[model samples]
Every structure is written in structure tokens, then in C-alpha cells.
Target chain A: MGGSLNINHLLFLGHGALWTIGLSVIALVGGGLAGFLVALGRVSPSRTLRLLAATYVQLIQGTPLLVIMFLSFFGLAAIGFNISPLAAAGASMTIFVAAYLGEIWRGCIEAVPRPQWEAAEGLALSRSQRMVKVILPQAIRIATPPTVGFMVQIVKNTSLASVVGFVELTRSGQIINNSMFEPFLIYSIIAVVYFSLCYPLSRLSRRLERTALQKKPALA
Target chain B: MGLELDFSVVLDRWRSLLDGATLTLQLAFIAVVCGGIIGVFGAIGRRGGNPLVERLCGAYVEGIRNTPLLVQIFLVYFGLSSLGLKFSAFTVAAVALTINVGAYTTEIMRAGFDSIVKGQIEAAEGLGLSKAQIYWHVIIWPGIERVYPALTSQFVLLMLASSVTSQISAEELTAVANYIQSETYRSFETYIVVALIYVALSFVMRFGFWLLSLALFPRRRRLGTPL
Candidate 1:
């Protein structure tokens, strides 16, 4: 029996690629909002909040994303709630990305020089006002490069959503392979698609990192 | 109906779980060691080899870095099989993991190499050391010593990533979890147990790396300063 690759398969993969991009966006926004809270909690003056946030990061970082995906997919259903695959994948990515992005943002936040904090305090600004007006603005500048770098990770990770039955690029490739029996070509195409999506962000991250390095001397 | 969890069934398969964990560790160990070797040479190539070699190394690192490990695994697995090369899943997983992690290690090691000041190499040359001696003493050892922490964490991440090999039916921890959960119908319990095992494994690996660094880099241990 002979089976051939066709335009229909390419269109299916194209649709899947869109879903992949869609899932990555969902993870980015959802994870970004939650991770922001985590970053703040990590740097919070309250001892208990700091400890809880640190614990959350440790627990999530210690566990693999695959397990988290599985838990959200099967565990929620097991607990008597019918969970959709997209919801499970998105929720798991949110939880997973929040941990990593929280850690990265924490580093960026802390990288804001000590003198800036002191100057803000010297200005008689309230703690909230100081953070909003001084610390966060500087931290955002430091955070941009790494945050863009993490976007590549988020995009690559959306492939894992395929495991829980979301019809993303990788899963669509698998579906096509099941019918066409052409694993190498289809998977290579999938890899190229991912590379195209991720390489730009990687380049941007590297460029930003370089500029950040260059900006340090000017700042000083 | 309320949720009730029972891990007893999963817990009863502790021996199989242990075997799977051991396999995961073994797979990770092979990948790290092999990848480290490739990385050191690759770093050197990128840093000092001919222009073509440097370009090739750069391409390899960028290519691997920009793709998901899942697809890479599929490509390697099918690519090899389609080429009429028959290998076991375990071997293929190890090969793919080594290749995947090697790209990352190359980048890290290249950074380490860049941080090796030119003056250090000149000093080694001033001492009339041979090329091999200068490379070993002036460059790689210290470069690695400085980047030990980064290297350790990378290897730990590699270990965690080894779970992905389960998709290829390489009987690692995650694959075992899949089987157990399917058999017992306690998916949550199985994955929770597997997750805890992974956490424990990472901690063990981190500790082991610390011990190893202490042994390998006497300067760090004695002087309490990075190289």
C-alpha cells in the first residue's frame, strides 16, 4: 500500500501551527499575570508570603511539566469535573510557566541596584509609590531580555500540549504520520516549523541581552 | 460524589518504579557524560577552530536550541529507522538526549571559554608549556571550574528532561508511570508519586554535583573562591 503526503496534510499542519501559537499566547498571558504576582510575592517584605512563594516555585520547578499536564488533564477529571484538553493544557502551562517566569523575574527585580531603592526611600516616597515609580521601571528594563528569551521556551513547550490530545503542531504531525506512514519527513517539517517560530525570539533575546550588557556602562 | 484518592495500588509496584528511576538516572548519566565530552570539543572548535568549523558548530547549537526536544526525538528515532538502522529505544533515546544536551553544553562551555582571559593563555605560553598542556591547564579546567554551578544545573535539567524519552517507549520513570496508571486507573496518584520521585532525584543529583565539584576543584574547596 502506498500513501503520499498531500496539500490536505499541509493544511492540517497549518491549522495545528495556529493552535500551537494560540496555546503559547494563552500560556504567556496567563502565566505572565500569575508570575507577576509570584515575583512580587517572592520579594515581599512579609516573611510568610516570601516563604510561600518560594515554596511554590520550588515545588513547581522540581516537578516536570509533563506530570503537571497529566495531573491537570486526568486528575481534574478523576476528581469529578469534566475537563477539556485545551483547558488542562493551558492551566498546566500557566502553572509551569508561572514558576519559571517568577524565578526569572525575581532575579531581574533583585538585579535593580541597591542604591536605587535607597534613593527612592530618601525621596520620602511611600513603599508602594517607590516600587511603582522607581524599582519596577528599572526592573522592567532589566527583565525585558530574559522575558523575551522565556517566550521561546513557552512556544517550544506548547508542543507538550499535544500529549494531552490538543491538536497542536506536534500532535497534528503525529496524526498525519499515522495515515501517511512518513515519520521522518513529517517530523522534520514539524521541527522546522518550531524552529521558525522560536529562532526569532531567540535572536531577539540574544540581541536584547547584548544591548543590556552594552547599556550597563552608559548607566554607570 | 467526593474525590477519594488511593495510592495503594501504585505503591505496591515500588520495585518496578525503582527500576524505572534507576534507568532514568542511567540515561541522564550517559547523556551528561557524552554530551560534556562533545561540548568541550565543540566549544574549543567554536572558539579556535577554522572558520568553517566554527560556523558548523554555531549552526548545530542554534538548530538544536530553537527546536523542541520532542520533535527532535521523533526525527532522530524515525530518521535512524528509515535509514535502515535498527536500534533499541533506549539507545536511540540516549543518542538523541546526548545530541540535544550537547548543543546546550556547547553554548555554556563556549561562554566559559570566552571568560578565560587571553593573559592566562599567554602566561601559560610564557612558561614554555606545550599546546596540549596549555589548553588543559590554562583554558578548559579553569573554564569548567568557573562554570561548574551552571553546568550542574544544566545536567539536573537534563535529568528531568529524560522523562520525555518515555514517549518513545524507553522504559524510564514516566513510561512506567504511564503503564501503572493505565493498569490501576489511578492516574493522579501515579503521576504524583512519579513527580515526587523526580523531585527527590533532582535533589540527589544536585547534592552529588556539589560533592563532585568539591572533589574536582580543590581550589574552590580550599580557597572558597571560584576559578
Candidate 2:
């Protein structure tokens, strides 16, 4: 308990940082897959589907990710699901990220120029073909910068997984602090690690946004 | 395993939930007002002529934006005590939230500020308006009007984020749910109820903001057009 910060503690933090990345990847992939469907649903021709997707986004957006974590972890356990912390954290993150990414992607999808959609229609393309060959390509270009920006959010939000006892970067710091009694120092290190991870993505997102903006005038 | 849903048990503690929701709203209110003030100044400092102030403001925004709020809350919660400052959990929660939201708000406010065309400010000056009058008539009000929607949404998000203060045991809505569930052994029912309450609160906040917007922007209200 009396020992100061050392290699083992730093090593533990490194391990936790790895998990933070792992959990973020899980969220991005799972959320991306689900968010794609949600984006599709939002833009779908079916009124019911669009309404349903919108409702899901609103509901999830309104509730805090922390509450979702609790509901998935302890709440599910009480109801007899007995989920592991990793599974619960991953599931929660996926649900939370899907709602946000879905909205972002929806905006991207909608941002596709009206003439592009009309052109696809004029080309006698089927609805699926139009989406696959035309609309999505444009949308992907519009989506890239925001998608990268949202990745920073996904990484930051992954810290909430620590509340569910997921042993991510923040939780590991808590554990070290429990023994070393150095909350500020440990948490400062943790914050720095998170900053290192997120700042690059933030910069990349901004750069992509600038390039996207430059390309816009040419396309127009 | 059999799944049975019973909300009645959770509903029995509605009074406590109400109290918690009230506290959540209070925390959100304080943070919004305080963070918003910080945001305005931070935005100004970023765009202002002083290179040092601009860089410092930029660093603050970037540092806050990149790190997780949980870590920031911990930093405030524990970092303060380590320095021998005594404060309540609620105070700590509010301060952390204010700091967190201020960064995002600064970015949004800066966008709002940037939307003001230079010609308008010059025109105000050509009309011989004082600096304070120019700022109010040409800058601040118009800037806020342009970004009202974004600003309100950010505030609503702040309200939702106030739930994180529960981690510090601030006795907000989420923390209250934690306590009730632990006592009642109705964790599922409790969180479900709490989540719905949050949804309701968000709607309430949105409606309130809409009403405020209507009153604040008479031109938009009269013309029925977005600024």
C-alpha cells in the first residue's frame, strides 16, 4: 500500500488501454453493422420502418449510456441472464453507439444530392441497385469524416464500460488507486492515455472534414 | 431461466425517484448556465486577438473533448480532496459537468460566432454604434440565434449526461435507481423505470427549450422560419 507508482502499475494500465481499444473495436464493428441497418431503416420507403427506427434512436439517445450499462449488467443478472461483464459492456456499447452512428449515417445518407437519386431513378435501376450502386457511394463519401469523428466518441464512451466492471483503462486506474491511494496521479495517467488515443482520431476527422469540404465545390 | 416482469415494485418508490429526477434537473440547470457562460467566454477567447488566450482556450477544449467524462469526474472528485479542498459530491458533480460541457459548448458557440459576417459588424460600426452595442446587436444575439438549435440539443445532452454524476454518488436519478434496486432486488424493474423517466425528462427539457426559443427569437416566431 505504501509503494509508489512503478513499472507493474504502468504495465497494468497498458493492459487496460489495450482492452479499451478492444472494446472500442467491438463497439465500432457491432454498432456499424447495426447502425447500417438503422440508417437503411431510416431511409427506407416503408413509413413503419422509418418510424420504428426513429423511435429507437430517440429512446436510446434519451437514456444515458451509464443506465444502459447498469440495465445490461446488473439488471440482466437479476432477471437471470447472468451475463459476463465483457458481454454486457460490449452489448451496451453496441446499442449506444448504434443509435448515434445511425443518426450520423442517416444525415450522411440524406445529404446525397437530390439529382443523384433522380439520376439513379432515371437509369432504370432497381431500388436495391440504386442504393448499392449510386446513393451509398455518395453517402459514404459524406459519411467518412463524421464517422471518424464519432469514433472518438465511441472510444471515450468505452470508458463507461469500466462502470460495469469491464476492467478498461478507467477501471484499471481505479483498481491501482485502491491500493496506492493516489487518485490524481493514476487518473492523470489514465486521462493522458485516453487523450493520446483520441486526439489523433480527432485530428484525422478534422482533416478529412476539410478535404471533404474542398471536394464539395468541385462536385457541385 | 424464467423471466417475469414486475414494475409495481419499482413504482412503489416513485417519491424517491421524483426527488432524484428533481436533483438531476437541478444539476443540469446549474451546469447549463455555468457551462454556457464558460463556453461564451472560451469561444471569444479562442477567436480573440490574444494568441496566448486563443491557444489556451484551444488546448482546454481539445483536452476536455478527448478525454472521457468519467475520468474527468474522478479527477475532480479525487483531485480536489487530494489538494485538501472540501466540497460536497453534488458540487463536485456540477463542476465536472460544467467543465465537460463547456468545451463542447465553446466549439458550438465558436461556430455561432463565426457565422456572423464581418460586414455586419463593420456596418454597425459605420452607424457609430458603441462597442458594447455592436457586440450585443451585431454579434452576441445574432450568434446565439444562429446556433440556438445546436445549443439546446447540447444542453439536452448535458441533462442526459448528468446521469454520470451518479458515479460520484451525487444522489441523482441514476444513483437513486442504484440505491432502490439494491434495496428492492428489482434491478431490472428499477432501471427500466429510471430509463423511461429519463426519456420523459428529455422530452420535457426539449419542450422547455422550444418554448424558450419561441420567446427569445421574436422574428423567427413571427416569420415561422428557422434562423
Candidate 3:
């Protein structure tokens, strides 16, 4: 086996990294939209809604993303629906990310203090107004550091998308490794690329967390 | 797809699914115990007086944390074959997860350690307490109690992350699902069932951790409050 690193390999990796970014955005945006609903559901006026959302979170959190991916890709086929790898991975990531983001956002919403909810309710605001105008705006600030920290997790976790043949950075590395049979070198480079992508977000998240802790004496 | 769904074929393998879930729990249980020890030592090592020790500990945490667990498993499983060590998939998966979770535990424990006031240590010292005694009574227990929730969540995540070991053919729940799907041609039903099992398993783990917390931290029960 050849142990060579070349321009073409670098180009392939670059392409893979771009796909990784694309997929992360898809997961975040798609998940974010669905998660907002779940978060609202979690704190809904209706007990049934809250219970349903809680069940959703519990079920999704209990399962692994890898299994979700398999379910999306192979499961769809087994059910007589033909789907692409992008569909499978994106769908899996969305479902997985929604549960986590829902829980995160739910905590943020609840962290806005009981008084704020009372004040908004006393102001004759509707349920929607209390959320959109009062609670969510405040909750987002509380949610920032953890959300950013979770971004690092999302990026690293895209590596799992490779298992379903999504051809992201990790899978691209696996492809090269198969040809070169250089597990150590290829995987190390891939790891470095992932570290470069993740470490900045990690540092930023920690910094934001520290700053928030200092300023927000009323932190939940 | 407009479709009727079927689970009978998948349900036929319930025995295997139960075994797989049991295996997953066993793997996570072993990793948590092994990793908790490493985490405690790693936490102590980070705060130890030796500069080399601190650097060594820091590097270990960062090296393991920054990389993906899948790669870590590959490294432990395949990367070791290059170095002439042969280990079972179960061992490799457990070792990799232990290493992965230990780094996170070290980070969490460090935060807990930092929360302990200097006055408490001084009080321990003023009472003629030795370093070991101070660590046990003043440092370790309180620190662990403070971060117990975070630690339990991490362990729960580890239980989920154990699914990655399917790649190494670790006969865990995900792996068993893989095999069953191939055999039964019921990938959807198989994964759905396996996913349900994981949900139940995680709930059980969380409940068990909650019980362990109440038992281990007397302050939790006596005070009826968090430490």
C-alpha cells in the first residue's frame, strides 16, 4: 500500500469539509425550527402537549444518532421508500438534533424566572405575546453559550454521518485510508481537521459561559 | 411511501434484542466504573503540584476530547494492531468509551474542585487533617456531589455513544440491530424496536443513577437538597 499524501487527496478533503459544513447547517436549521415547536410544546398550557413533548425528548435522547441514521437510510428502504444518503443523514440529524435542541431551549425558556411569566400574564398579553415578546428574547441570551458549545458537538458528530455513506470529511478520510492503508496518518489528519473546526467554538463557548456567569447573578 | 408497517418479524428477535440491550448496559456499566476511577485520578492529577503531571493530564484530556469517539475506537482497535496488541472488540469498545468519557469527567470534576473554597481546605489543615483525609472528606466527596448531575448525564450520553461500537462488531444493541436487519430484512422495524430498547435502557440508567445518588450522598437525603 502506498503511504502518500497528495494535492488530490487534500482537494477531496476540502470538498468533504464543505459538505460537512453544509450538513451541519441543514441539521441546525431544520432541527432549530422543529425544536422551537417542541420547546414551546414542553412549556405549553396543555398538559397533553407537555407530556407529548417530554415523551419525544425522552425517546430521542434515549437512542443514538447512528441508529437513527440507519433507520432513515435502511429503514426507509425497508418501508418501500427510496431515499438518498443526504436525505437519510439529514433526516436523522434533524430528528436527533431537534430532541436535544428542544430540551436545551426548554431549559432556557424555563430559566426566564417565574416572575417574568407572571408579569407578562398580568400585562394582558396573550400566550403567543408572552413568549415572542417576553420570554423567548430573554431565554435566547441564557441559551447562547450552551448552544454554541453544542455546535462543537454537532460538528464532531457529523463524523457519524459517514457510516451511512454520506461522504463527509470523515468518510472522505476513510476512503483515502482504504487505498493507502495508512490508518494512523489518515485518521490523524482527519482528527486535526475536526479539532480545528471544533476547538474555536469550544473556547468561545467557555468564554461566553464565564462572562454570563459573572454578569448574570440570576442564572438558572 | 404509502405503507402498512409490520413488526412481527422484528418482534421475533426480542430475545436477541434484550440480550443486546443487556450487553450495552453491561458495557456502559463497566466503562463508567473504570472511567470514574480514571476521572478521579485525572482530576487530582490536573490540580497536583507537579508541572509535568499537569501537562500530561491536560494533554490526555485534550487529545481524547477533541477527536471523535469513532476514531478513538478505530485507534484502540485497529491502531493497536499496528503496535502488535490484539484485543477483543468488546474490550476495545469499552476501553475507547472509558477513555472518551473519562476526559469529560475530568473536566467536570475540575469545575467541582474549583468550587471548593480555600477556607474549607484551611479548616481541614487546621484540624490536623492529613492530605489524604482532607482529599477524601473535604475535596472528593463534596466535589463529586456538586457535579453528580453533570456526571450522570455524561454517563447516560456514554450509554448512547456505546452504539458507535457497532462499527467494531461489539454485539451491543446497535450491532445486534444491524445483524437482525440483515437477517430479517426488517430494517425499519428492527431499528425502531432497538431504538425503543435504548430509550428504556437510558431511563433505567438514569433512574439507577438517581437512586445511587440518594444512597451515596447522605446530605442529599438528610438535607433533602443538593450539595
- Per-residue lDDT over B5-103 for candidate 3, one digit per residue giving the tens place of the 0 to 100 score: 789988988899889988999999999999998898999999988999999999888777777898788778777888889888898899989999999
Interface RMSD of each: 0.9, 0.8, 1.3
- Clash count for candidate 2 is 0
**Candidate whose TM-score is highest:** 2
- What are the lDDT scores of the predictions, listed in order? 0.92, 0.94, 0.90
Candidates' chain A TM-scores:
0.97, 0.98, 0.96
User: Retained native contacts per candidate, as fractions?
Assistant: 0.74, 0.91, 0.78
lDDT tens digits, residue span B1-227, model 1: 97899989999999999999999999999999999999999999998869999999999999999999899999999999999999999999999999999999999999998899999999999999999998898899989887888899899989988888888999999999989988988888899999999999999999999888889999888888753
DockQ metric for all predictions = 0.81, 0.89, 0.72
Structural similarity to truth (TM-score) of each candidate: 0.98, 0.99, 0.95
RMSD (CA, angstroms), candidate 2:
1.0
Please report the candidate that would top lDDT against the real structure: 2
- Higher-TM-score candidate among 1 and 2? 2
Q: What is the lDDT of candidate 3?
A: 0.90
Better of 1 and 2 by lDDT: 2
lDDT, candidate 3, at A193: 86
- Which of candidates 1 and 3 is the stronger one according to DockQ? 1
What 10-residue stretch in candidate 3 chain B is worst by lDDT? B218-227
